[model samples]
Target: MTPRRGGAAGGRASRVRRAVILGVSVVLAAGALTASPASAYLPGPVDDPLRTAGVALAADAAADTGIAFGACPKDSGLAAPVQCGKVKVPVDYADPGGRRIDLLVSRLRATGPASGRQGALVFNPGGPGAPGLWFPAVGLKSAGPVTRKVWGTAARTYDLIGFDARGVGHSAPISCVRPENYIHAPSPDPRTANAAAQTRERAKARGIADGCGRRSASMLGHMTSADMARDLDVIRAALHETRLNYYGVSYGTYLGAVYATLFPRHVRRMVLDSVVNPDPQGVWYGANLSQDVAFEGRWADWRAWAARYDSVYGLGSTASRVQASFDLAMRKLAKKPAGGTVGPGELHAAAENAAYYDQRWVTFAHQLSRYLHGDDKPLVAAEAPDRSGAKAAENGDAVYLAVQCTDAAWPRDWGTWDRDNSRLALRHPFETWPNAWMNLPCATWPARAGEPVDVGAWSAELPPVLLTQSERDAATPYEGALELHRRLQGSRLVTEVGRGSHGLVSIWNACLVSRVDRYLTSGDVGDADARCAGHPVPVPSGTLGAKDANTGRYY
Candidate 1:
């Protein structure tokens, strides 16, 4: 996703770009797995016996007139032995003749026996800014177990496809600031009474907004979700598929929902995990407020779990005491950042991940315990930004803001932001301020906002869509999943009872795994939504008092 930039705005542009991308990266980086390199290509139109007899098609379309699949560039880091290519799509679909942007696409052929080839399944890791080129590898490795059980083979039953969404990795990314400006700036501390620090945070937000406007003005207005949905259609056409089979998480779920609304007939077996609420009123801003409250609840849950394992973690024997210990650690880090870099804010970014995924709970507790014991090394390492001179040619951070800030009109009035955040902080303290400041750039963003797509309903006949969500998910709360199911007539919702993990299907929790697998493989779900028990809460690996895992009970 590398794009060469003119050297005119070198010094200031670099600084601004780094700061903007880093801020967006920290918050949006949840749920997505670490990236790995792979090569892949777009499927060409030429008819072959294998295509007609083997791969399943959701619908019939004209012969593919798409770019020929070709070898990936040498430095592509795509070592997975797949095909890769670039598809040129209109930068703004409204003005198709205006300009074009190249989207980097990749595909992994179905590795199952020829008799079992299902079709192409598109995978999105959900950041809106997250680069999905590594998804094929993620599916091959992490999802191998689940796919193996469902299809009777390990590689994959369908052609696993991944791409860098527009303005993301490998796409024509939007750049606002330099990578160096991604330092630990002070965010508004809900507990902080310091007016001066609050002013600085506001200034920081303003600077990022202005920097992006000045540096990436041309790319800003064109990065909305509507445009991204249009791009998906182009990819579908190029792949010669009449319909799309998708698995989207977090922000990706929003993208998936929008796609289904815009092109209902073009869907086949869509799976939306950690579903986003598609209510027009909450297109981008209100969801963050929902996240704040949800994260706080998950934080409370983590504390209680830690108290239950007091013999191993020694944080406390009760939830309140465990929370106090965490507060003490944050205070210590605030006085002096651990390792001179990991401050209270950085620690929040690192530890907050636990609120979204249960698997992170044990590891985060261990790190917090060690931090209390004077080893902030792990905390610092978890969020250290890339200082390496090799910055991304098209930073995902820039695009995240571009799409979100432009997706729907964000409140332009700073006073509105201040009042709303202040009010929300009283009840939702854990993430309210940090999350507010993270998105505050939208208040003064340079992009021209687009009309938000109406995703509430679709009149066309659509495939049976499967929606999944953990009951306590902080990122995309469970209510959003129910809302999406309601919007999409006949869609089935699967709830992970008492769980908070973000990405559900291909992970642990056999109950969730079985439901999603069945939906994808057979396209058959109950006439309504189903609820499944969560994976058992985990304790420190060697805890002697560990009860029967399925019970998830401390005794």
Candidate 2:
């Protein structure tokens, strides 16, 4: 892949590189790692005393590649000293010399003994669109479950590295709709909307696609999982490593599986948390439909939990009554939006985040109860975007649509989409239509879709890898993880029995965390489908810790 000059606009800047891998530029410029180019691969400590201790540089491996690393800016938010770099890779692997884009990368050196140091541990926090540049920093922190459970022994032994994938944060991003379009636009709700409302929704989807084509037409077609997997290989080579060691959560599991399939021998030790389905039929459409069912089930779980503490919450004493209260809230929001902004669709979007993590259950329930009692401040605050960095948030949403729509073929027939969503909406009204509208741009997506990776084949040549999933996960259902385990030979599937949250590995399950830690440290998990009962269900009233609501796993 050739690295070409990029058009200057927004926060993007162009960087030039010599043909040779050595002598790559490393300038510590202003702002985030996304804004400037850094030095080529350098081994050892650069700055920052806290992180520089016991560091080992991969200068021997990086010397041959056209990649460099330099110290990050004063406020990169990394707990340790980290070296940041940029890699220019082909937009399309089929034509390596045709067009190119820079991929932003950051690395934190291992703090363990050099002799015992494992290679770089690559991380993807999912989202197919979430920025991972700060994830490694999260791993380095001394506090929090993510640092303890997910990172575990790997945190001490491996160089924790994170990168913003193609068309995502810090990497050349996909900017589709204008920020004004997102400000107060009511999300489409086919399940309850009138004929006129439905028409507006359909137009919104089409409008999103048209806007994407107008702004990012040339790069839209190349944002597939396959393209992303290829980028991982380039990063691995630049890291001066022969094999890839990965920890992928949510959508990142699919990305890791694709890399393993394309380059099986290059995989050393992998941990896929919350696995995506390997079935071709489920790539884009079936998987989402399945989520509707799973999310409903998870919501039921939440209702049951709420019922257990009805004396405190006062919503209801039974699951049915609690569900009724929720239904009433939605109905009220539909008739009159809270604070003149949060309609039924906005309420759904706000509550959807709560469905993924149990800790947020109290916050959401409190906010809803407050709204019903004639206060809209909390509800409006929930609906408001993070203005601290609106551009970053907008970029994430744009890349999300760009990658999901182009990764695999969505039904070209709007009739098929409409029929499926309409059918699902009958039994699964909670997320069916909202999810459909979120992805509706695919029906008229300007870019053609790519062939999905064949992930069902069981390859015996690859080394043993570990997989974890919650039995009641809402995003990537439990069945997908089982199917993935069945398809991938020499892999261990550690099941968090009865855990309803997505990204089960290190949130709060001690059994799951111990097993993952052992695997990453020793590269061994005895059984093919191991089972472990996770931590007890969180109570509604108490300030229980183990909260990871904002970690941004793909779900």
Candidate 3:
């Protein structure tokens, strides 16, 4: 396949960027490594020397490539027969051995005896930082019981591959911002009375952006989804797949999009969920605007649900009251941050978490109340996503920042950032500024930013692929789902109405799961625009109480 080039915009950027991989900082797996103009492929450390052994979990030989893999034995949280090892990839594809960095690979091969099933399903949870190294083991267990049974026969059919992208997990880490850099004080004003803080936040946001120029400055020039896409192909070549069948969520959708665009013919039974819009403009700032809007919807949803626990929260009898109390807490936080470190950014960080799922709402409300009235535990342990294993997400963040900055030029002029934040915050004060701060580093990235790859969506040469999406997803937003569908020629979009989170497949809704199963097992992607409408949303309150409700209520 010709390596498609990208340029200034994802369209124009497409002309300059080598079409090998895609990018993202979400779901299970995000970001693919690629080659650059400068030769910089450094090999990585080979941990736990690979030993050839036959085990139930790790495969000795890849199905398609016939590449031999030596199991690097290790263990993670889930006690599955665990195998850990390293895949030596180019640090800079241009220079294969300048500085080697081992990419941590893990696996939880198919359970049960093998019948002939399709090959391994590579699962990426996004987060660019999420620990995918451990997911293969967890996926086999968590795909629930049935996926296992199918995969068991399918194991004879396929194998499982989990990899940590550059600077993530077991890979050489790049910790740009230390935990000490984070502010964690409680808010005292309850009205955002600190004018000093707003200015400080802006300055810090700018500083963080500039810091990238110092620390990962050279890295900034090379980190792009396009680069990572190339790295995946090396892996595919190693795995020996004639084509790759991938499952990506949130940012992974972007990864999958770039891959399908670059190697359309190599795609087999792909799933892009809670899709990311492949638009380059959206890639820079427009995407965050969507995030602010998406999180706002989630915030509203959380507020409404808090009403049920009014007695426990004492925040309100209705969701509105709860929202007010939360807003008051933010105002208070703005005045005096938790431990004086966590600021408006931190407050909104927790708010964004509430937007993630219902299981987390009570904790968000309880913690917000504690911070408001006078407590620090809940506030300190706020809405942050748990990233315990291998510190994969942390490493991914380093790599994510490096590549995203290298891919494009963010507004380096502080005024532009200020102006943009001011405008977005006016409407989306919830997570707007924090989201801005999260991506601010892109502005002053040190590396000479390259062009973005024009994701070639209209690929008639590509085989039909399946795309799944949830209605109220905050990360990717439903609009992106439609836009992506518009790009892929032979693509089939299967909608799961009113769903949240990324990659809702195999989670539930037989209607949705079955489509994925049929599509993967048999190369049939039913008629255009197939849908599992009005899907029954999963409620935390259990099926019985859910059934008893007058019915407008959601868990």
Candidate 4:
């Protein structure tokens, strides 16, 4: 999950944008594909599951009633020439005629010639709730060099498609609380909460769950990734594509995997980055626990980086000393929150970004230094709870819980959670408690949990898939990628050795980028798996800019 926090100011946004543009420009310069007819790579056959469900293939009718692409919706944040459209799909594929929801989709049409056009390349930016309508623009706007190259290559031969999954973004969005009431009330620091405080935290989690049931119960049950995968088929037929070319990051990898399992023949080329664990047993509860351990390691990496620049940051000269400094700062914040708004929880939330991307290490170190020196503004600005985007954040959080909490059965007994999380927290204190609380709502999720798709069931039937991961990715650890690779019989795995970043394709790693570019452009997966050296640890260069600092909560 992409941890939610306030973003950096002007410096970060400009820097992120510049990085994106530079990466995209390089990608556009890569070699192009030889001309080929679009029909050359049509899907072979429909799986029995889809064929049996009469409504499943009903979307094929969309071929006759194509999407009406027009001016992009103002709220979509898309610029001119990029068209927006909608496709109506059943809220429940099991009962296609029951209720329907509109899926908001955007398209950046292929820029290359008609004969060279491959088809639509669908994208999912992985929140399980992150709005993806802005994804197509990400290639031209903000991703890293290699990611941009892959996008650049696709843009030349494919019409890139981005959409808000059902019950998210502009597609009949669901929210558990109203913006004005969705305040981030301070809670006791998770790292130090006692039994009574733990009980109170559970109550808070239960309250959130109850609120979701009360406010958006109608849509909660339908938010599973399985249903979302079905929605993708509807989108495929609507676009008149015989096969889907997909790129999924984070939670999106799971969605793509489900789609491939359900409709194996309908997939042409697929790229899954930062893969989610495909083990049915680890559906989500176990996955989050695993993340706790991984995040701590990444956090340690950040502290070590800070120690390397102790003269610049004045935190400490050794990783242990940096940890001590961080502990001292936390104690001070516990006594009195910076700016009276950023308490321990908020500060942790802001600093946790360091675990997700090394790009934020310098900025976070600076924020910590400033806070310790009595200038709390940077720390405050990094995590002060903003109410303006509360509705959007609430919607994303609701959907995240709606999907993850219901995707698989979570331990109903609060004691199981308390025991497991407490045990893990003892060894990995960085994000254990915070993550446990973030997912605590699952203990009493209102909807009945659905069984995760048997991801490996149709693995042998799938075409070669390309998988990428940074060895130390915090969100979806490297082990998940290995597990997924083993499950997907013929898939290729590209490991970014020693890196800890969450998403690989969006970073400026040339080695991984070239591999992805080659696969997407020529459908080559070589004879075996591949490895790429990770980009070196970023050195503090006079406090370079950050990325999407103000983007609301994501998972």
The prediction achieving the highest TM-score against the true structure is 4
Tens digits of lDDT, candidate 2, 471-553: 88898999999888887887888888887777764476667777888887888877656788765655443422223333432
Instruction: Tell me the deviation in Å of residue 26 in model 2.
Output: 34
- lDDT, candidate 3, equals 0.57
Return whichever of 1 and 3 wins on TM-score: 1
Off by over 4 Å in 1: 1-64, 73-76, 139-155, 185-193, 389-394, 542-555
lDDT per residue for candidate 3 within 347-378, as digits (tens), equals 76666665865445556666776676677666
Q: TM-scores of all models? A: 0.83, 0.84, 0.75, 0.87
TM-score of 4: 0.87
| Best of the candidates, lDDT | 4
Better lDDT candidate (2, 3)? 2
lDDT of candidate 3 at residue 253, scale 0 to 100: 77
TM-score, cand. 1 vs. native = 0.83
Residue 345 displacement (Å), model 2:
2.3
lDDT of 2 at 105: 87
Worst 10 residues of 1 by lDDT: 53-62
Q: Which ten residues in a row have the lowest lDDT in candidate 2?
A: 49-58
Q: Scored by Cα lDDT, where does model 4 land?
A: 0.78
- Error of model 2, residue 409, in angstroms: 1.5
In model 4, the Cα lDDT at residue 546 comes to 30
Please list the C-alpha lDDT of all candidates, in the order they appear. Answer: 0.69, 0.71, 0.57, 0.78
Model 2 spans > 4 angstroms off:
1-63, 73-76, 185-193, 456-458, 542-555
